[model samples]
Target: MAVLFSVIPLLLIALAVYGAVVVLRRSRQVSSAWSSGITAQARCVRSYTTTNRSGDSMVRTTLHHVYEFTTRDGRVIRFDETDGPSTRIEGDIVTVHYLPVRPELATAKVPAPGKLAASTGCALLFLTVFIAFAIFLIVVANSDSMR
Candidate 1:
């Protein structure tokens, strides 16, 4: 029992570190793409709404969007995105950003700085709380073992 208590904190810290790295990498990738990628207008070719029942027996609806864009070399690419229905419709034009070298790596928009910072902050905050709680548990377990 005591061995589990001591090991859990280390594992939690490792997990927190891994989560932070993932967030940082994603932030950098979007930032780089926005700075170095090309922009083009894409058309929303198809869209549909899916309805399903949740575990709580409540019905939920999800909107799926499919888009197509032509590269500078006259190549057309089509892909699906799940960023929500928004106000776009079939045959509507949307802006897309893509790497010139690898046009398939693209996004509808670069993440805003404010939104990225807020999410990173939230991840760190959760990690801090989790580590603190794990340490507290270890301390309590050790004291009980010593007594």
Candidate 2:
């Protein structure tokens, strides 16, 4: 049980580190993509499906495809890598920053930096709380066995 407690914390820290690294990589990539003129992004979409798991029904989403948005410059853009979840949505007129050479590889601009920061903070807080709870569970289990 004590081992579980310690392992939980290590896992949380590892996730936090991973998130930081991702953010850093994104920051660098976005900077290089920002050009002097307008860069367009495709209309992103997700296919919804209804499914039941363990008696609880829920809507599940999967990547359908991406539609390239045409700017005045007549350039088609899409994602260079499809591994990451999309940050855009249909009918969303998001500001896109793309590499001049590879317009397909682009990132949608966040409308509000402060709001995004707040959301990121909340996500981190939730992760921390979950980790704490896991640790508490292990501690209680171990102490019970000790008695």
Candidate 3:
């Protein structure tokens, strides 16, 4: 039983590490992939209305666009914007940063510089919370072992 308790915290730490790695990797992939910027006008924007099990509605958005581009690695990503609120905008002048390898995949869109930074900060904040929680669990479990 003690072994199981000890293992559980380690497992949580592992999971936390995995989550952090995934987020950081993705962030890096997106940052590195962003190649060029374009003057894209918003084509369409719509907010989503999601219903949960308890019948509550959640608001989300889906943005679309039509544009052209070249990749940094000569991937030739083309066509419209297909990402929503958090990542894309339509009918507005957007500076799109795309991956060089896959011209089709854009790493990010900064609607406004300030907002993008805020979004990145929020993601990092959540990552910190998860990691801290994982450490706390390990510490508590280890202390219990001494008694």
Per-model TM values vs. the true structure: 0.64, 0.50, 0.53
Q: Which candidate would rank higher by lDDT, 2 or 3?
A: 2
As a whole number from 0 to 100, the lDDT of residue 129 in candidate 3 is: 86
- Estimate every model's Cα lDDT from 0 to 1: 0.77, 0.57, 0.54
Top model number, TM-score: 1
Clashing pairs in 3: 42-90, 42-91, 42-92, 43-91, 48-60, 65-80, 65-81, 72-100, 77-103, 77-104
Candidate 3, after superposition: displacement of residue 43 in Å?
Answer: 8.6
The full ranking of all candidates by TM-score, starting with the best, is 1, 3, 2
Q: Where's the lowest-lDDT run of ten residues in candidate 3?
A: 39-48
Q: lDDT tens string, model 1, 1-147?
A: 888888988798788878878878766655665766477899989988888887887998887788899988898988676654478789988888777776765666544778767877898788889878888988998998898
Error of 3 at 62 (Å): 9.1
Score candidate 1 by lDDT.
0.77
- Which sequence of candidate numbers ranks them by lDDT, best first? 1, 2, 3
* Residue-wise C-alpha lDDT for candidate 2, range 3-119, written one tens digit per residue: 766677667767866776675566556556664355664565442333434545655544433445665577655553332335445554545667666566576653344655675
The candidate 2 region of ten consecutive residues with least summed lDDT is 46-55
**Regions of candidate 3 where Cα sits further than 4 Å from its true position:** 32-35, 38-83, 86-96, 107-113
Off by over 4 Å in 2: 1-55, 60-77, 80-94, 99-105
lDDT of 2 at 144: 76
